[model samples]
Target: MQPVHIILLIVAYFSVLLFISYLTGKSANNKTFFKANNSSPWYLVAFGMIGASLSGVTFISVPGWVESQSMSYMQMVLGYIVGYAVIGLVLLPLYYRLNLTSIYTYLQDRFGNYSYKTGASFFLLSRTIGAAFRLFLVANVLQLLLFDAYGIPFWVTVSITILLIWLYTFKGGIKTIVWTDTLQTLFMLIAVGVCIYTISTEMQITNIFSYVAESELSKTFFFDDVKTGDYFWKRFLAGAFVAIVMTGLDQDMMQKNLTCKNLKDAQKNMFWFTIVLVIVNFFFLALGVLLTDYAQKNGIDAHKDQLFPIIATKGSLGLATAIFFLLGLIAAAYSSADSALTSLTTSFSIDILEIDKKKNPEEQEKTRKKIHILFSFVLIATILVFKYFIADQSVIAKIFTFAGYTYGPLLGLYAFGLFTKLQVKDKAVPFICIIAPVLTFLTNYSTIQYFNFDFEFFVLVINGVYSFLGLFLFKK
Candidate 1:
């Protein structure tokens, strides 16, 4: 596909998103932006959460990841099922009962102001990095495939990426995202299915699941390897904790769930979301197997993050594959990026500034708009940093490794708050959370350097344990 054709496809895609934004953004206030006035359908929220949770990183990187990881990522997917159950049964009830816009508010009520602020601050930092990582992958791909053809610099591409998200998301916030994400998720899934079919046909694989099962690369369980990252126990447990903190405790994800009309609706959403997410992730892995085999047979040197993009856009797969690939890539990328932008704005405005407490609607909206624009630029700059320093490794691996530290504190804070009734010194709480991650990092470094036994996915569990122990020491 030509660069001009890609640009036109993008323009048409965002036009639909903007039209959805226009319809949803009318009369949207902080309440609508933050919670969609608690009127979103449960099914839409369930479906939309898939796109946000998977993001562009999964779309492009997960299949590419199979070269090294194989289907062992499924261990984490299984773990996610357990994690989502905890959210549905445990966390969702608490959030609904308390009527919270920001889940960090629970930290305040349970611990103290400092603890609440610490929790929210960790989420802000963690999410900013996470969102930046996702956008970096997609933006880099966009730069390679389209922008570079027109002599556009990477910085210009990154800026345009952020600006486009800000355009439709500045007003409606979660309201607009609730609908736009559903559309994007649909496009993303369709693209995956189409690509799988096209490649499977060329390879003459009649029964995909059977063929995937028969192949050597289709190994899903890794019980024999305890020292590696893909081991079942490590990945499964990490996957569980990851789902809990990154989804249940995350403002961007839970923000959408909170838009549902009631706790029951939200619980139902989580149930369906979990089922679909597992199936979807399996498909991504299977697609990875196919893409890898196709690349090998045809002698395409592409591997890791470059595999899918190189094969999909190359002339061999046909024009339809290229068209859907772009649509799917954009849909998957923006589905998460747009929501991250809105949630960061929501958290900063409500959690940091407490703007929702003000009486004037206009003032609150004004504050939100400014913060919205601020995060848009924040994401833009962060993506540029990733391009410069962090572009070599697969994007998904970086996200999970980073999550082990950034989100580990959140897992600890929430676990401490919910399971324990004892109070700790408010000022001491912040110090504990900060020190926990630092110590966890030191421990992780030592384990890998000296012990030669890398904790890998278990780092989150280890970090959570450190925070839990720290909180216990400080309990009154």
Candidate 2:
């Protein structure tokens, strides 16, 4: 409830993570950091990926999203099931068979150096922005609820946040993250469960499920409006592609899956991760339903991104609820971020710098530590930019829209690589990737201006199609 208490909660929480890092950090090298020496347990990786996948966006934004979007996010969550299948059965096998540290290396093998560098560069840009976006949202909440009361500047809060991630992850990398993510996921789920149960009890609802089911905000499908953001098919199909690109094709996500001891283990991890992710997301949207109802009945005027935090801290939810809320938010935010930093380092080292091709292991490790610090600052700067320039939209929606541009080329390149045997003009890929997102934006703008229809959730799908066509045209 108090700023001091929140600070103490964060301190105690990271203390546990730092202790885990100490244990896991021993004998750590680039291999342990990159692939966890291919020793991570499938079950641990599966459980940890839940926290990494959701991040602070879902923790705060999803619950708040219920007021405007209702339960329509479930369509995208359902689509994730389809996407994860592609990851498990298709992408995982390919990555494992190739023994890849960075999944983008597959592009070099399939295409050439130019296409490979293009894919890797796109991933670096996408994940840097994505990770920054995730941290920015959580840091804003911290500034609002805790830091502002102490007259702390927002930049200070963000710097400290990024610094903590680097401290623990700098040594053990994914090996430490596999363990820390498990703890974070546990705290995250516990927070959600606590809030759901406490809020339902406060509202005096006898059947939580029945209450959620009966609420108008609980409406999940939107088949009638084919043009709106909430349209079922549009969201479902988009959700599948989002998962495929953001997870399967992503270095930050696939890096963890690659840590598993074998292909079967990684596949099993993806399967279970999907099942739990779907169920966990439902609880988030359900929490959103309860928060919105609670806010309305109490005459609190919050909506969108502010709904969950306002209610949890200011809406008389008690000290226990507040404590867990901060923990959950921090857990969710850092779980993904720590891995993002590591994967960025991994991708850059392997894909961009070709550190692996060199003979000196010690030199490679030194280079990685410097890159780790470099990205830590990069995240800090990006968050500062978001604070100044980002609009008042729900943060999750912002992430997906941004991904439509950043990850879309990745989807097209991978699809072109895997499905078609056509040899690509590798030199044109960097240029084609740039044009795909630009074409996507123009098409989306034209549709809205001329026909009053927007791409909404279909942004990635449209961009990917554009990218595929672009690649097809330039094929050798």
lDDT of 1 by residue, 1-476 (tens): 88988999999999999999999999988889999999999999999999999999999999999998889899999999999999999999999999999999999899888989999999999999999999999998999999999899999999998999999998899999999999999999999999999999999999999989988889998998676777899999999999999999999999999999999999999999999999999999999999999999999999999999999998499989999999999999999999999989989998899998999999998999999999988998888888778857788989999999988888988898889887888888888888988998899889778876678878898989999998989988
> All models: lDDT?
0.93, 0.93
Question: lDDT score, residue 388, model 2?
Answer: 83
lDDT of 1 at 134: 93
The number of clashing residue pairs in each candidate reads: 0, 0
Model 2 TM-score on a 0 to 1 scale: 0.99
Give per-model TM-scores: 0.99, 0.99
Q: After superposition, how far is residue 362 of candidate 2 from its true place, in Å?
A: 1.0
Candidate 2 has an lDDT of 0.93
> What's the lDDT of the predicted structure labeled candidate 1?
0.93
